[model samples]
Target: MTLSVQLRHGGPPLDFAADFPDGRITALVGPSGSGKTSILRAIAGLLPVRQAHVALGTEIWAEGNIHRPTRERSIGFVSQHYGLFPHLTVQANVETALIHLPIGERRKRALHCLALAHVEGLERRYPDELSGGQKQRVALARAIARQPQVLLLDEPFSAVDRSTRKRLYIELLRLHEQLAATVLLVTHDLDEAAQLASHLLLLRHGRIVQSGATSEVLTRPTSEEAARLLDIPNIFTARVDGTASGRNLRLRWGPHALRATGPLPAGIEGDLRWAILPSNVLLVRPDKPWGSHLENPLLVIVEEVIEMGTEAVVRLQPQGLSEARLQMRLPVRAVHRYGIAVGREVTVSLRAGDIVPLHTGPAR
Candidate 1:
């Protein structure tokens, strides 16, 4: 069943409407105080909003004067902290969600859920006795114990270590396949959202900046704000210099001229913001001669190289454009092989198709 939500609230004012597809994972991603959690709360009937119209298919959860109670809604919520009861055993915690079932059936269902969550042997242990990952698993068992129609997860893996988080990601995928429940996940990590969610909603200041298929929103953000929120670091101001060959549009950035694949935004005659993904910024290798087929090649001076284990984030300033710096990620081995360091001049290429024209005029 499709989960539809229309909410408007005061205080920090939130206003948005969206329809989450049935049996698909939709991620709500944004910075803090962006109403990711508020949307979840509003759906679960935990938040008192000024106006709300929430429904699963034709069954109304909240509309007009009617508001369904949290427990009545067929949703399972896992909070950032897991929300497992410290005093209860894992089995009892999960059993709490199955209370609507007969007394004898609850235990069996809860145990099955624990097994599905891959925490079968830990049923007797209390939440305090379990590790962070274990607690998260137990929480998942509890959430799915009643076989809810919608799963609401708020930073469910935030407390775990990287390796554990990865394992939990696999487990979540496994459970998702088995349960096939609609999931609304709230996360600050874009990578996590990209990995798990098919649809993504980018929120900022209680408003949805963009919402679309995960890959589309990540690659082709509708606005400069959305690009910035998604952490695309290669944003710069450029003026439309009219059309290039074929479908490419000419752009002038300071003294440098660039080309982007586009029918430029309608009636945009002047300066506009443009951004490219860091992954699209390629560093030309010295051993392998730069290809002539490459698009925008600019000589840049390496200003910073941040080593991130296997990969490095290199910031480069275009030779003559002191005001602009481009960020790109390269393999650590490539960084060492190229001897990429501060003050080193190197060439980087930006493909025409990779350059995305954003909002018109300078950012506010």
Candidate 2:
């Protein structure tokens, strides 16, 4: 069953509608105070809104003058803090979710859930006795003990260490595969969203800026604002010079002319914002002189190179530009092999298909 929601409020204003597909993970991501958590709370009936409509398939959870209580929503919620009862043992915490079940069955069901969450041995411990990761696992067990139809995770891994978070991600994916529960995950981490969610919703100031398949939204933001929010650093304003061929268009970026694939807005005139993903910008190898065959190859000076463990972020300034810079991400090995350093001249290729035009004109 798909989870559908429409919400509106005045203060801290939220006005957006979204549908979370069944058996798929849809991540709601944005900077802090973007209404990501508010949307989740509204859907789970934990927050009151002026106007809202929330439904799981044909079952309406909230609508005009009607709202169901949180308990009746059949959702498993894992808040950022894990929210485990301080006084309750791990097994008891999970068993609370099974209160509606037969008294004889609650213990067995709770134990089963604990085992499913990989915390069976720690069931006798209280929240204070458990590590952050262990507490998170217990919270997960408790959340799923009742076998909820929809899972609501609000930055569930944010409190854990990086290695623990990665392990939990795998566990969550595995559990989702087995249960096929519809999940709406709220997180600010873009990498986490990309790794876990198939669908993505980019929220900002209580509004949805974009929504689509994760790859599509991440690689091809529809607006300059969206691209900026996604932290894409290679946006440029370019003029539409003319058509290059049947499938390509010529764009003039300052002194440089670039070829880009189109479906550009019809009758589009003047300049528009365009962007390319850092990973899509290719560094030309000295051994292979195939830059001649590439669509957009430019000789640029390496302005800065930031080494980040196995990867490096290299900033390149095109030869004749005043302050414009293009950023590219490459493996650390490639950085050493190509001798990419500050103030060094280098050649980088920008594929026509990878250059995404943000809009035909100014974003509405």
- Using TM-score as the measure, the top candidate is 2
Model 1 per-residue lDDT tens digits across residues 200-253: 999987878889899988998768888989888888888889875556788888
For model 2, how big is the CA root-mean-square deviation?
1.7
Cα lDDT, model 1, residue 285 = 81
- Kindly list the per-residue Cα lDDT of model 2 for residues 1-364, writing each as its tens digit: 8888999997657987988888899999999989988888888999999999999999999999889999999899999999999999999999888888887799999999999988888888899999998988898888888788999999999998999999999999988988899999999999999999999999888888889999888988888888988999999888889875656778998788898884555555688788999999999898886836777988899989999999999999997887899999999999999899999998888899999888633233
What's each prediction's TM-score?
0.95, 0.96
Winner by lDDT: 1
Candidate 2, poorest ten consecutive residues by summed lDDT: 355-364
lDDT (C-alpha) at residue 334 in model 2: 98
